[model samples]
Target: MANITAADVNKLRQVTGAGMMDCKKALVEAEGDFDKAIEILRKKGQKVAANRADRDSAEGAVIAAVNADKTSGVIISLNCETDFVAKNESFVKLATDLATLALNYETKDDFLAASFNGLTVADKLTEQTGVIGEKIEIGSYEKLDGPFVGAYIHAGNRIATLVSLSANVDGAEEAAKNVAMQAAAMAPLALNEEGVDSAVVEKEIEIAKDQLRQEGKPEAMLDNIAKGKLGRFFKDNTLVNQDYIKDSKLSVSEYVKSVDSNLTVTGFRRVALA
Candidate 1:
């Protein structure tokens, strides 16, 4: 067996950002061969990654980036095991870098496969997990494109929203940003009643009817009452039909019309760390 020196272990730790004991063990297991020691550390990282694969990583930041023209944007959620690690500067920086990468990569798989410095993002994440002593992952990712795309990151970076508009007008970008904020706050399920899942609509209607029946409402009035209740649900849960949070007097659709009559929300994406 080759002798493993303290100097060799320290050097390996510096190069790999792995724990001291981990570096020492790798050096001992590699027979003090430097290159083999590095490989051992990488494999150790992979092992850690595999061990923590099932761990919940709900604490992290939602980040976003937009193009110069404000016509394209990307949003991403970087998840960690604890809030302390989530607030770490290094973790937040990694989230920002990933959000930037999401601008070019359309899917989470692509973002994970993206290159970071000298290694792929997945490998880098594995290395980070070993160093940070926790599980970490990309919880969600999305790219949006339209005539006007606005991105918003809510308090503590916990929620991210992207709003895409159908028209590019004088105030379209500003309106879209407000809509993004609305999404972050209201958690709308879809763009409008048309976008909501039909099954969900039916379920909501049935729930409404059941509640009315429990109240001893006449069966003859069930359909009309349930339809009214369904309308209320859509107005509360759909993006355009929702009352504008900033100006409750106007619906979101009305707010957009006030901004630019031709401008409308084409689509939106929202992601939260939880």
Candidate 2:
């Protein structure tokens, strides 16, 4: 067996996120070959990680990147089992780099198979699993490209949003970014009422009527009551219809109107820890 020092184990532990003892054992098993040790750790991680699947992974990071030209943006969710691991510098860095890399991928499946730094994304995750000793995954990815694109990553990296805007304003990037941040914070479902699914609208109307009847409202008033509630739902779920966070007097659509910009939000995405 090759000699493996405590320093070597510590170095591996830092690099892989694996425990010190696990790192030492892998190094010893691999005869102190760092590359072989990494492989050994990954194999072990895959075996042990199966049991961690059910652990609540409600803490993680959302990362977003907007291209220099503001023509493209990507948002991704990198989920982990614990807040401690989610806040780890290594994990945050990984999430950032992955979001940057994912800009070239148009679909989630392609992104997963794409090369990340030196290894495939799946391999990279497996290696990270060995190091971090936690279950982590890429929960979602979204990309948008248009005349202008903007992104917002909320504090704590828990939420991220990407929005593509068609606006002629000189500061459209900044404005779109602000709006994207609002969308992430408010959890908007659509750009406007028309953008929402008809099925969803019908479902909401049904729920509204049921609630009104339970409240002892007359059947004759249910339609009118549901219509009023639907309007409120639109304000709650639509980006353009929402109350502007910066100014309560203006809706987001009204706020955007000041720039004389024909703002058409072509795409938007939001991701949060599940």
Candidate 3:
């Protein structure tokens, strides 16, 4: 058998993110053929990654990445079968690497078409599917971008949110991320009162008026009832009006009062399992 050098093992480790022993073993198994050794370990990991896919991936991760200047961010939900696999070193590595790839692609089709290692992202997932024998999937991919952005991945990587701000400020990105975290938990519709659709408001008033009339409320009271109901609508749909999950004493709008008034939520995206 041809002697495998330490240099060869290190090279494989750097390329594959596998352990020292695994690299050495792969080199030996491939008879000191570096290229073959790389494939050997990759195929093995791919199998393990794929086999883990079929298991309920409810416990997998939410990964996010931002451009160098924090002008753009990508958030992704990568699911595996169980918390065990979710915490697996290989699984986490794959998820982060995939997130990096996702940052460059705008859509799912584009992401799948992109290359990962020697295989297209889609093919890698397919190969992993075959190996893990579980249902592995890219649950969601979201891109939030503008002049400035921030991202937050909640515990267990189950929830991910990205926010874009209109004006730059100290800790502005982090504050926007808090808002995103609020959106993930509260699921708001509009960033503020003005952002809410007037049509939706009108429709909501109509519904409230109808319900009031059905309840035998006097017509005079119907208008007041409709107005009163509108408050609930705003509270439920508008981010500024919604209760801040972090601190219920203040609405999300109230929380942002200390920040620059111009720092509006230009856009945001929240992702979680269906």
Q: Pick the candidate with the highest lDDT.
A: 1
TM per candidate: 0.87, 0.87, 0.73
Over the stretch 185-217, how does candidate 3's per-residue lDDT look in tens digits? Answer: 887777776887889888999999999989999
TM-score of 2: 0.87
**Residue-pair clash count for candidate 2:** 4
Point out the worst 10-residue segment of candidate 1 by lDDT.
38-47
Q: lDDT by residue for model 1 over 65-168, one digit each (tens)? A: 98888889988888889999998887898899878877877778977898986778888888788778788888887888998899899978899899999888
Q: Is candidate 2 or 3 superior in TM-score?
A: 2
- Give the per-residue lDDT digits (tens) of candidate 2, residues 33-146: 998998898888776567676766677889999878888888888888889989989789999998888888889889889997667897787677656778878887777888
Candidate 2 displacement at residue 246 in angstroms: 0.7
Give candidate 1 regions above 4 Å deviation: 1-40
Q: Model 3, residue 75: what's the lDDT? A: 86
Q: Is candidate 1 or candidate 2 better by lDDT?
A: 1
